[model samples]
Target: MNRVITVRELIEVGGFDETAVLAGETFLEKELLGVTSFDSPDGHKWLRPGEFVLTTGFPFLTHKESSESGLIKLIDDLVEVGTPGLAIKLGRYIESLPPKVITHALNRQMPILSFPMEKAWSDVIVPVVRYINDKQRMELVQTHAIYERFHRHLTSGDPVSNLIPLLHDVLQSPISIHVPTLKWNWETPPAMRKDETIVYVDKQIGQHAPRWMLNQPLARMTNGLFVRWLLHDQKVQGAILLRQPDRDLYAWEKVAIEQSAALLSLEMERQRTVSETYQRFRNDFLQLLVSGKYGSRHMLIRKAEEVGWELAEHYIAVVISVKPHSSPDVETWKENLTLLETIRRILSMCDLPILFGLDQHNRILLLMPATENDESAAKGILTDLMTTLALQWQHPVYLGIGRLHHSWEGIVQSYHEAQISFRSATHAIGLANAPLLHMKDFNELGLERILFADKPGAEAHALAEEYLGKIAQYDKEKNGQLLYTLQIFLQVNGNYVEAANLLFVHKNTIKYRLQLIRDLTGLHPENGQDQLMLRIAMTVHSFGYQA
Candidate 1:
């Protein structure tokens, strides 16, 4: 808080008590920070904002032009420089302010006051400067006290949430804290939840958190909202918002908000450090579970309970990864952690016995309690959750669930199955249009499950070449899609019209391609044996491209 005096207050002082307003009376509330007496023609250029200028109108009197337009131009320069007001001694160098000058000043809302010619400039300068210094000293003392109060809370190890009430009391108004990157928010009464204006602002903050966090503190927004950014390690981590319904916030209130923001930043950093440490330990425990390293069932259960994980008789493994084409930026370790935490936060609402961590491949791994009756509900929850995550991340997400199994050994088997299903999920995306959530279950993989289980070897390569290699080579040489047509034909169960529709070609074109495939591969799409061989070969051949 600067604690500067306003023109309205300045006029109540001893030397200014006899002064009269010549124009722009309504803007007397403009703050006056300093006093200056200058007669240089260009001295206004050097004047700082909030300074009150005292002139005898001599700059205009001795200048080349010394006309009404010249005085009006001087007023314009002063107004442009953001001077609080002008105090001009009258009936000395100039008879009176020109009517045009008064009108211009009035139009610009620049305060113009007439000083009494009898009083010397020293009378106003000396006392006004002393008064400003005294107010500044008071401001420093008050701000220091506010800092001490906030520091006490910080040293006491209080969380960021506990500081909101203190800030609200200081501002004497409703307030909100929003940390969109972490999906965190808090508000005092007259909840921001119901305010559509503030909600829209929050949405904006969510979409542009990385960029908006660096914005200046105390930035004004719609509906009398003042935002002070919470910065940590030079990054904007969150924001503290103050709402003034009936009036603007005072300078001192803003000072308190700033101090509170610093405390919030420190507390949030502390929370993040604690969270990361817990995640590291949890990750180690997950690695142990998936690796089957625990000594016995009883020991595993005890270890799980320590991390708030409830061991269930039956569990299913789920793996989540980002779609390849979803983003161009390399997924850094920090981003992966953010994605993992996001999944945990969303899944915690399901009230199921669930354990979350990163797999050996650095993808999100989940061990969700599975019961025969609740499997469908769990899948539904995952589908909806993945869809929500996709929207939140602004990209498609891949999800894979393994078959449910019993006991510790089953957890390891299900985890391996999940890794296989995770691969299938990525391939499934290429088989159709990309949905926001691409999900696959190991049990539902059908014939592809066998192909995924079989490692690529001499036998697999020979089978692929014996079945569809010629057709693939022909399509490549002729710039054709015969191999693709056969696959689509098998996919639609030999419906020529359906295959043609999926391929976006004429039905006749589909028949022509199938004929070419048969001619080139000596296999037919309508024959059950031939179709099985062709599908298996195509599935195996696709594996050659998987990472």
Candidate 2:
């Protein structure tokens, strides 16, 4: 770090040795960055932050109320411009400053120092400017050294996590690198920020000037915490946060932090590229694995092993079919991409080897290791996985789990079974009426296997129309919800109260709808045979409607 000269330090310099601290003694520690001697009446207007000002006090001599408010106002202006201190030759400026001026300067913490009349302004300005210039030169050298060190780390293939200690060494402060979407962290915090705030930060991302260093903080959190955004392609990909440092960071330290952020951004881009390539290969491998096209099963297993998949004695296949939200505002592709990424991150933490990839149909596919013939354990794992995934998504995302299968061909069967389970459920009941997240397992499918395993042909469609056509026509003509009510009633298994509660209506309404359904289809609501037939017709009708 380059040494900063403070107002107190200026007193020790050769030209400033005879200066007396007249007021604002508490702010003698203010950093002095530049010095200027201006006698113009409007000279205070041109003053900058951290500059030390000097004069014969001649500017105040012409003030109408030079001994009072006019002097106080001048002091206020100097303080507002953030001048480190004002050094005045008091004897030459119409005797002395008013008491109010000193009181105001002291209150504002604007240092007021005095020098003898013989002290030339050049004696002060030349040495201060030289000192500042020398410090800046040293800072440039230090900044370059830090940059080279980071460059060496980047070329040496060190991971971003390893670079944290190097930054800690330079800053002597707690530092963290956070990529929240990726759930990657080098240190403790992921940073506390609202979603909209993050979006705003992203909008402001660009190549900022060096003056932004230390002067502008990306985030204004408390406890001296600040951040530098990690940008990739002009987008904020992540951030590097510095917390509770001994003091504010200097320009060179900020430069080092920025360089580290650049390195991290580069690493993220490289990882993303590598992940994309790996995903393509993984997708292709999964397609081939489930297609049963490979000649040698052992070779296929070896290939899976190479990709870090442990082909257990038994494994269950899971298929997740993403149903796009009904809202036009939702982007289906972006939603699915976020869902898949969330799944990948959560599943990566599992103890058992779980392989994930997209099937040929573009549905998410997972082959999770399981014990031989233990369907319950696999279901438990799938349940936990689905529950975790559900918490991350706002809308319902459906999943189908196949029975555990052993051989390569069995893997294919398991994959198909998984796909069929979810498709069957969707055909039976629409996505809107589904739970927050839907998980259907093949082993759990009973009559649904017979009801939805095959697509209903024209004959099956006709049977459904024969039973439901009258009610459907009634709904279309009258804008009635009898069909919807009947569907809900059947779903609740003739529990009038439950059905009514689901529809937000009275039980009598459900009974009335049931009677109307019976009158239309000539089927009794309480009769088992009639109920079964109605259900089959409804399922078939749903399948046809969706198709």
Candidate 3:
């Protein structure tokens, strides 16, 4: 709690006769000026005007050579050097301030004050200094307390449930800490309305929020305040918004909240990292199950249960299939994952806990607790989620949901069922036309083995050889020009000028070769579906098609 001593407080404490001297009404120790002990001018070069300088006017101003003109000139020089105000000792100086000096100070509004002849300058300055030092010390203590609370909550391994209570205790208010990152369909806060007293600390996010809770007068004026603090250390990690009662929060309180938020942000990141590691292991475990390595799945379930998930709970498997309109590379997939993580985080806000695992088949499986307690509401929530994701990513995704099962033993069965439904949804009439698919049809499970098959190495090799054989024949017949053009075009994703530059040919030459390839293979690179097939074919030819 930094004490802001007003000019009035200074006058009262210093025993200055207000009638004899005038002080600027706006002078503040923390804002307009800061007080520092001036023992020597040796190391205080950065001191400038607008800052009140403290001194006894002792050694230099005492000599006869330092006449009234010299004294006035010294004040003038200090002011000229950006010293907005000055504090002087009265007893050591000539009995009283000269009329000329007072008049000069009054005209410039440069505040000058005299301490009581008996009161030492050090005594007057000490209280203000002490106040500031004590404030800083208290802030340090509060910061430590915040970290302790945060560490306890995070290490206890329950974040969302513990966060509100921990923050409420620290802020001394009923805090609602809303993480937009964790709510998939959550709307962004809108611009603040008039008569709003909420403060926003915004982090850099690519998208804007569409709604603001502080926009309501009741929410805004109920002594309720909003604060946004950026998570400085993490890339793509969103901000923390603290909404507390509008009781005056001084510098120390603000510092404490900000520090606590920073700690929470770091802990959230750590938890995310641990979750990702667990998901990766889960993914590997599930893949082993699919590959008939049942022992690995059993081991992984044991390890996961140790980490807090109740393996015996009824769970449902959901498989998310993302078929890029055009074939996407690894970098594209990584960028998409950032957005997917945001969506997953949002879904976690619901009472149901979700665990995400990515399989070798490029499917995202979410293991959610199976209770039809609010199945309709959950579906509505999921529909909004799909819509939001489609709008955000500008691509379509298909979802397959499997029936609920009793335990971890049934996960593989549900997963296979979900995969079948995923394929059936992608192929059925009117179903394939829809942007989102809920696997309500259980009969789709019959095609599970055929839909998701693990091809032998020989069969995969044969397919690759057949595709490349055609491409090689086309290239040889055209003197290797077609293959060369295809390489450059695909590298640039069929951008003419870029491909031309890479091939050291005119854009027209590259375009002509692309047209020639289309004529030879009956595959138009301009069509997204054809382009995707060609891209996959090119990749398989270049790198053997084994996961």
TM-score of each: 0.71, 0.65, 0.44
Tens-place lDDT per residue, model 3, 228-280, is 43332233334434455433455555655565566666666767788778767
Error of 1 at 421 (Å): 2.4
Best by lDDT: 1
Clash pairs of candidate 2? none
Error of 2 at 229 (Å): 4.0
TM-score (C-alpha, index-matched) for candidate 2: 0.65
> lDDT per prediction?
0.73, 0.71, 0.55
Candidate 1 is scored at a TM of 0.71
Clashes of 3: 15
In model 1, pairs of residues that clash are none
- After best superposition, candidate 1 residue 234: deviation in angstroms? 6.7
How many residue pairs collide in each prediction?
A: 0, 0, 15
For candidate 3, the per-residue lDDT at 527 reads 71
Query: Which sections of candidate 3 miss by over 4 Å?
Result: 1-9, 17-46, 53-266, 281-329, 350-356, 363-381, 390-547
